[model samples]
Target: MGISENINEILLDIKKLSPYPEKVNLVAVTKYVDVETVKEVLKSGAHILGENKVQVLTKKHDELWDYSVNHKWHFIGNLQKNKVKYIAQFIDMVHSINKLSLAQEIDKRAQEHNRVIDVLIEINLFQEDSKEGYDYQDFLNDIPALLTLKNIKIKGLMTMAPYTDNEDLLRNGFKKLRDLKDELNTLYFNDSLTELSMGMSNDYKIALEEGATLIRVGSKIFE
Candidate 1:
């Protein structure tokens, strides 16, 4: 099957799991693909594209200028403070605001661009040493500080489950993220936290079952 077919299949699967399929955003991860492939993805009907690197995203944004009005760009990797300026102008949503300092920098850049940026606080649910995100307890402690940043709207939480075939582990991880989002909204953000960027190509189905509003899928769609 081609990109279009893959997207259709994924959308169908999403509909199977989610009652409100329209609310689930399918972000086609285009980090490994070239501009031509990305254009094909957009043409295939996956209008929301996610890029991991600032340089690649900037380059693709320029090359795919015509799709700007209809498509949106999401920064899905570990965003650096300095690199925030490059994407601030066009990034529709950032799925990994990992630290307080990074949030401050995004706020500054968004202010410079005269636009408020949408962002998700990345939570290291399992305390993985390899991951770049706030520890679960740390994030809870810093909620007040994160809320103080005026230019970036905290959409919700994002997490990448460990790459394992264990279905139970995946479901639990995704559930934890969903619960955290609900807790944060009820206690701190007042139900404003909406998007849960939890799923990827590997465990997106489980993530969707648990309540993932945004799922980042790459190789599956491109293959």
Candidate 2:
């Protein structure tokens, strides 16, 4: 199957999962797909492409520009502060914003790059020691510091739900992220926090039902 087939399948699956008619975004995670494959995907009406690493995105981005294809570029991995300037030059959005210091660094670098950075507040809602996010209690604390960043806008929340077959946990984790996203928007102190980037190949259906505006899927589209 190719990009069109994969996109059609994901869309049909999303439509079957919810009745709200939410325009879910399918970011053709390009961490694995090659340039020719990406060109084929672009021909299939797929625009948004996600890259998980700064170096990989820079390399692929340079390669893609040679094809003269204009598409949204999203950085969906851990971003180091030192690389923010270079990363900001290519990416349209960053989805792994986990700390205020990083946010501040991104804001500063984006200013130098003359681009306003759109970032998602990543939440380790499951509290996995191995993962990163603002904890439940520290949520309020994170919000204020985030608001202080002038060049960066908080678009929404992104999270990595615990790897589990338990449907309830999966659903609740997504719901929690939605609830947080809504609350951040309600603060009104900052602008609207609308985009929720959650879910992946295995649990995207549940994530969409809970209002995931952006889904970073890999294997499903890669195949």
The segments of candidate 2 whose C-alpha lies over 4 angstroms from its true place after superposition are 188-191
Q: List model 1 lDDT by residue over 1-223, tens digit each.
A: 9988999999988999975677898999999998888888888878899999999999999888776448999999998888998999989999998888899999999999999999999988867789888887888777889888889999898997888899998898888888888888889989999899988898899888999999999999977
Error of 1 at 152 (Å): 0.4
**Candidate 2: worst-modelled 10 consecutive residues by lDDT:** 182-191
C-alpha lDDT of all candidate models, in order: 0.89, 0.81
- Local lDDT at 74 for model 1: 95
What C-alpha lDDT, on a 0 to 100 scale, does residue 138 get in candidate 1? 83
The residue-by-residue lDDT of candidate 2 on 1-223, one tens digit each, is 8667887898787778754546678777878877788787777766889888788888878888767666888998888888877777767889988878889998888888887889888888888998877676566777767777888988888998877899899999899888877776666445478788988988889998888888888788767
Candidate 2, position 31, lDDT: 86
Cα deviation in Å at residue 219, candidate 2?
Answer: 0.4
Candidate 1 Cα deviation (angstroms), residue 105:
0.1
Candidates' TM-scores? 0.97, 0.92
